[model samples]
Target chain A: MSKNGFTRRQFVKAGLLTSAGAAVGAGVLKPTGLWAAPAKIKGPVKVGYQAIMSGTLAGYGEFHKMGATMAMEEINKAGGIAGVPLEVEFRDSTLKKPQAIKNARYFVDSWGADFLAGVDSSGQALALAPVMAQLGKPLMVTHAATEKLTEIEVFKKGIKEIFRICTPTYQDGNAAAFVAQGLPAKKWATISPKYEYGYTCWKMFKGTLGKLKPGTEFVAESWAPFGTTDFRPHINTIMDAKPDGLYSVEWAGELITMIKQAKQAGLFKQIKHIMLPVGAAMDVLEGLGSEMPDGVWISGRYFFMFPNDQRNIDWVARFRKRWNHYPAYVSETGYSAMFAYKQAVEAAGSKEAKAVIGALEGMKMGSPAGERVFRKEDHQAMYEVPWGLTASNPKYPFKVMGKQVVIPPVEFFNRPPFEGPGTHPPFKG
Target chain B: MSTKATYAIYLGIIAGLAALGLLGDRFMVYMGMRVMLLAIFALGYNLLLGRTGLLSFGHGALYACGSYSMALVNLHLTQDPLLGILAGVAMAALFSLIVGFFCVRNTEIYFAMLTLAFGMMIFSLIWNLREITGGDDGLVGISRGSVFGLPIVKDGQFYFLVLFFFGLTLWLVHRIRSSAFGLVLAGIRENHQRTSFAGIPVKRYRLAAFVVSGMFAGLAGSLGAMLQYNTDPFSAHWSHSAEPVLVSLIGGLQTFSGPLAGSVVFVVLREIIERYTQNWMLWFGIILLAIIMGLRGGVMGGLEKRLRQRAATRKGGE
Candidate 1:
């Protein structure tokens, strides 16, 4: 026994005393109200942005952050939203769902964020959705493309706080089907990661293809685990099927790995056409470089070259200047989402969650991608989704999308057979 | 008399904490639930590491197995929350039985590596099995069920439910620690050969401890799954498995309450540090290093030892 030593009893007593002191201190201390102090209005309306700040998906997170920062800067320079400046409180999700939820809670509960925004992974977005619903906070999901999010099973069944700005997986699947239908491809084989996003993409593409061209034989379907580095076996299986075309839904590192492996194995040359649902990212394209097999069609959430609008051009230029690279669909989607949030806030004329949600529903907001609106019936964003043919470009460092077409949102998004009961207060016309 | 008083005091503190958690805002309530859950997990880990001297690097698999079971049961089977939890526990127990059969064979590092291998295998299995487990997208849109037939809709109600489970787990662990089975485990930990010579089945005792630990961990995991409203493959990852080990080590592996204290401190610190800076790992590493080097017996263990010493010195002076 030492002089500084205290027994468990003493320590417990001390802990209780400390807790009592804390309680008293809390009572005596001047309470800070939930809302930010009006007099402390700074340079901007600080929007705490938390996303995957680092990891394998670091590049995408950085791009999304850059996009949000650019949007904030642009909005502030353009007299700001509702005459108040906009700033961003950037937190890192580290590409983990738990961390994403924690950061979301912190942003809303502690930082007093005006709006919650940005998500890269569908799982992360889904995890944060319930919290957003509970908090009655508007979250503009920018990157995650899982259609189940806005479906009746999820959002309509009381989780109505999520507003997906990115094109849903179903939309991308339809775009692929639309492209595939026009091509001289009869049999289709699919290799997608086994997840909601990948599975949904596969199902929707197959279903859409079936609807478009009857008697299209589905030769083979290989479901690789997400983040599986080895695609050799799967590629071999796909090649063995010898389908006229291939549909690949693998994205990020897995996609990069598959593309390189497929190119080496000469699988790309054998298939008449390859439709990668998520290979349109600038990072992935750049990573693939010349190895990104030519003539393959791909659909993405955004393509810097697809939109010929001045807004799109300006956004690309600004983003390029800041990030030192072409903006991916994710970055563009994030940028568009923030702008959309501002539009909704302005339209609602209040920061109230329900009011803003009402303002967002069916309200068209202009972005570089064009006027995108959230279908009031379901919260799915309705807009032009970009699909393009892949081609090697010496002018740029990476592969670029060539001969692109923007699929109208209405053409693909199935309106009826909503997944869940609508909990969002009925649209007041 | 001292033990009884200590028990009473701990109960009082726990009750007070629960009340505070109920009264606190949503953020506090959420954090409180997290702490309770983590504490329950750490307590389970402590049974093996602290009392039984068995270090498991694969408990996360059991935890995740329980969570996924809960998710599966909740999604596909009956949404009866209690039934879902029971299903989770049952699955975890079954998983532990299989893994523990192979794991309890070796000693020290071999045991650890075997557990790690098993845990990693489970992680890979969960990550790859998309149809059943949802793979990377995870099992989403899970309904948070009721507790003991009571609606756990509100944060306060959920907090109490978590506290109830947490308290139940704590009491169970305490009872086990003080029981004759616990003494046998301690004997096996202290000297396996001597225990065997004394006609005790060292292997059986060790396996029993592992099974009990797994069951409690499963309960915690199931609760966590319900709390998060989803279960991802990460729950089964080696990193998650390592968390309990870290919690136990940091809290000091000497006492029953060490892991509980460690979990509380670790989670709270993580939350506070994350709020201030994004580079939390650097700070965390530094703090953990300081604690390990400075405290020796871990934060709580060192504190308790010191307190006992001071009380002894005062008694001697008197």
Candidate 2:
């Protein structure tokens, strides 16, 4: 009833307020963050996340927080789960395992968080696995790609309550193999930093690529100690191998530094084919920028330019609009894990750990990465890993995953959605 | 005040705090346990740097050895947590026997560098040995079982246990400071050449101090791992070794109660700062610099001087 208008009865008889009130109410729902509804949920669902939030790997944490905050915000604004708002808490791991485990416990024991997620370091993830069962809460690993986390190691100890939304390291190798199938250069050699991650990824890539393309003569292998700054000697050794193609398993800052060294050594000009399994990651692309030379084959867990779906485009646009940067693969992983947790909570219709675990088993959800299903048996998500050739464009800075080689999840996985050799299963599920 | 009286007052304060914790927050008890453990670490570290004039840069390796030994034994061996704790200290002592021999042969910077090299070696080993040590992934699932037949499921009980150990360690340090052996170590710290001339085996005394300090550190490490529920190679890294040194410096190396006060302040400050800002490390650095610069001889030294001046003035007035 307007102030200057007549009585409410007369106004109602004239139907003066109904249409206006309805239109305004409809407008209210259109904007984000105005979701107001009576909650069916009993209480607020609190999520605690641990990651490498300090030291050299803090950027990873930044992306993780951004992605996680985005999801939590969206869900909360969209009337929340069962009409109850979601909350998030974060702690820095300092890139150390003990700190991560302590942080996880603090969240569980001290803060009474409903669930846990966000591990950036593979070491931290592995350490958190067995303890997660003791903690009795689900730990959805957002970015750690180590195979043993979901495979025989956890199985050996009979550990559960651990699920990974990101693809495993073996899948990265498989994607590298798929891309190698199209290249003309047959002669091959390997160069990589010496570590479990490097050794496993290169070993699987060799096996798969060799299986796909025969007569790929193994020439030479050069290994660099982890944290080796000067790559001149390693580059010289690779050039001396005189292979037509080279596969290097390295990532992040070390990879970026070596690429500059390789350019100075002119190894890219010398070799007709070259590839790095993680060269196209958002950090790698944005990190190298114009320094990322042309013609090198690279891959990412998820690249912004690949597939070009409308959903992905919208996600990327919103990310750029918010962070002023393309969403990294790790960002997508964090984003997906949060959504998966939300779905599990909604499907269970309760926030109890056991109930959520039951609901999450074989639960299906959509993500910016793509549609993914959480396997009931081993708790692994079967998702695609894409690889592509590097190309420069005047429209934007940094290398785009141009000439994209989209590898389907089925090609690498052997009878997935349960047990797969790619997931490093000890036995057939 | 007399040193004995000071200790009596300190004990009374601790007992009061423990009593208050029975009705207060369990989180406070846990924090108290952490503070006590840190004091133990600083106490062990001070034995070498303050009493013996030996600056070791490799305490991290010994510290980590203690935790790993405890953690592994708890996971596999007897449910008796006391045995694990003893084993942890024993392992560190044994390691000290080997490492201290080489380290004690040198003095000053050479000794420091030797300890550093050894520490880094242990760190790398922990980082690489994925099969046995779990590499950087760390050893998890450490059991927080009982020492005797008494079960410790409550935070209050654990805090009391830690307090008991801390009091014991402090008493041990007190005894060592007044004993003949302790005087010889002090003499060696003052003048190793003169002490050698006075028919004392200076090198041997230094080595013994190193072993004893390692044992104390091991005890603290084992207790820390049990309380925290995990131990990693990062515990063996050089930076972890620096913590006690920092505490000893910020407190007063010469004062008996300095380590405890410093530990309480450091832990409390860190926890509180973490709640406020993500860049707490920066704030920590600023506070550390202020303490280092503003205080004359660390917190204890400055406080003691003020007390002595006040006593002199009161005596004059009387």
Candidate 3:
């Protein structure tokens, strides 16, 4: 390898020669196409990142990238992952699945990425998660919330290269459902963006809530298409149903639009209660602000203020000081993915994908979000999910999640290895 | 030179370029395949807009239909990439035929709206149908299988496969544009009322053009889906459809090579701008605005206009 950087030609040539050499020594050849030993690298631990860095979804992608950037900077400053400096190459996924997949290949086949990370769209993640087996590189999914990554049939067939550092859809739904069960109102309705994430969110919430409260009725449900700017009709339909409570799962900018419209109409006031678990996130909080109605239940995977542990406080302080904004949950997840990677790389004492996977399989690490343990069964990181009622506080300028409650991991979340990755949360609901 | 010689020269140029792409850097091979496939897509789109004088806002859905059919067939039906590609083409043509029947009756904006409506219907179907279409996740785990006996597992090999089709499509486009059928289509585009007075079936000719455009776009979409081994619902979106229209317009509408030029410019510009900053859409928007304003009839149209003026000036001097 050259001192500067290795060209794709050289890599291909070297690979061909090695394979040819192995063929000459037929007795020594291995079953797997590649040689058993991993290549020794002398340069930075390069990460190929894909996210929506442009267009409407830029903020989410930017925060995710920022988290990753801070993680890389911190790691390098402290002496990098396993004494090798870290490098990250960013590509705009344009919030599209095909683009994300293409970027994944380009990063490996073209950018010579050591490991791949980052995606903001659950749609991107759903398409990308299954194809990880072919990439043969560890992809740390930091932002996308699709449980389908681990729960889907193809993924259940044993995909190893894929891992998520963020909360999955079901877990978020489970916590939301668990919280909703305590409410006085038994009747509920759902208004969410139509997609896998929304489906999974409502399904899991309804499933868990149904099991808990057998009489609870889902009085109304409406699904607005993703990136929908107008939510008037959907809101009107939900109001007409007149359920005592509402379950919402909109994301980013669209969520803000939905809230503003819902508020304009007397929908929030008419409904006894409302639940927008993701809508209470920093982005929505910052955008909607005083417009965000009071006395409603909401949650974010990370609230930046909660946990308030020394480690988290310092991380947030540093992040805010640098980025000039409070760290979004996506930032925390992206940051943690890198740190988990650093831990795994150092623990394994190599950058080999297999070695890193082995080290990270069941590893427990404290993250800014909270304590996280990558469940060996499904390779999903189990962490505390922070949920709270949407309330304004004097200390913070934005909508503060009051009555803060951290939802512990569901029992079924961490399955025994013998039973397999566990059955996907039943679709009986 | 004879027609056969001209055809041979075009094939030769394409083959040479394909060989160069195979030996070029990874991005060149990757982006080159994308450009070629998109160029193919734009060719069909330009036929409707420039040759048939029919504006379609629905080819993105047609393109998506192509890629999705290819992906689904590969994933569930067969391992043969050829079969998947054929399935893609057939599906796209069928979609266009159904949509075109209604779309071709009206002219201009009505036709545009009809096509757009049909296109969004496909988009909604793809978006809402989570089980078979994989919803927004799209169809994944598609493989580019061996062709007859030759393998096409590598990017270089895939580039050659696409190149062969690119040449074939070029020849087909040339033939269609030059034939009596082509003359009738052009006549309809220029003055439909006059063509009707001449006793030509204008609607039938328009439908044929629409089908032809759909087939070519479908072919490109299938190859593109195979190129990535992935296809998403976005492929079937209005935005995807807009891509071909943009390429044809920017490269110069009404020019045979305009779509190809536009596709090359569009892909290369995005690739180049994306390298420096994530805000490629901003720069791209600005560049496209400038090109549309400065070049007017598109880059190729402007060039042709200049050439015509130069010929006129020379003749005046003589």
Q: What is the TM-score of each candidate against the true structure?
A: 0.88, 0.86, 0.88
- Please, what are the lDDT tens digits per residue for candidate 3 over residues A107-159? 88777887998888777776776556766888988877777675552236577
RMSD in angstroms, all models?
12.4, 6.7, 8.7
Residue A257 of model 3, lDDT score: 95
Candidate 2, which segments miss by more than 4 Å at Cα?
A1-43, A152-158, A181-189, A206-226, A410-429, B2-7, B13-33, B71-80, B140-146, B149-164
**How many angstroms is residue A64 displaced in model 1 relative to the true structure, after the best TM-score fit?**
0.8
Return the TM-score for chain B, candidate 3: 0.94
Better of 2 and 3 by DockQ: 3
Order candidates by lDDT, high to low. 3, 1, 2
Error of 1 at B211 (Å): 1.4
Q: Show the lowest summed lDDT stretch of 10 residues, model 2 chain A.
A: A420-429
Report DockQ per prediction, comma-separated.
Answer: 0.37, 0.35, 0.48
What is candidate 2's lDDT per residue for A1-429, written digit by digit as tens?
Answer: 668878968868667555665567687654224343334467789899877777767888998898888888888889787667888888887877656766776788778889999887777787787567767899988888777777644444556688888888766676677778788878788778766677677877777778778777768787776678888888898899899988887778888888999999998899989888888778878889999888888876777775577888899998889889888888888887878888888888888898888888788887787778776666778766667778898877887766766666656753333353444211233
Question: Which is superior by DockQ, 1 or 3?
Answer: 3
Q: How accurate is candidate 3 locally (lDDT)?
A: 0.83
Indicate the DockQ of the complex predicted as candidate 1.
0.37
lDDT of 1 at B147: 64
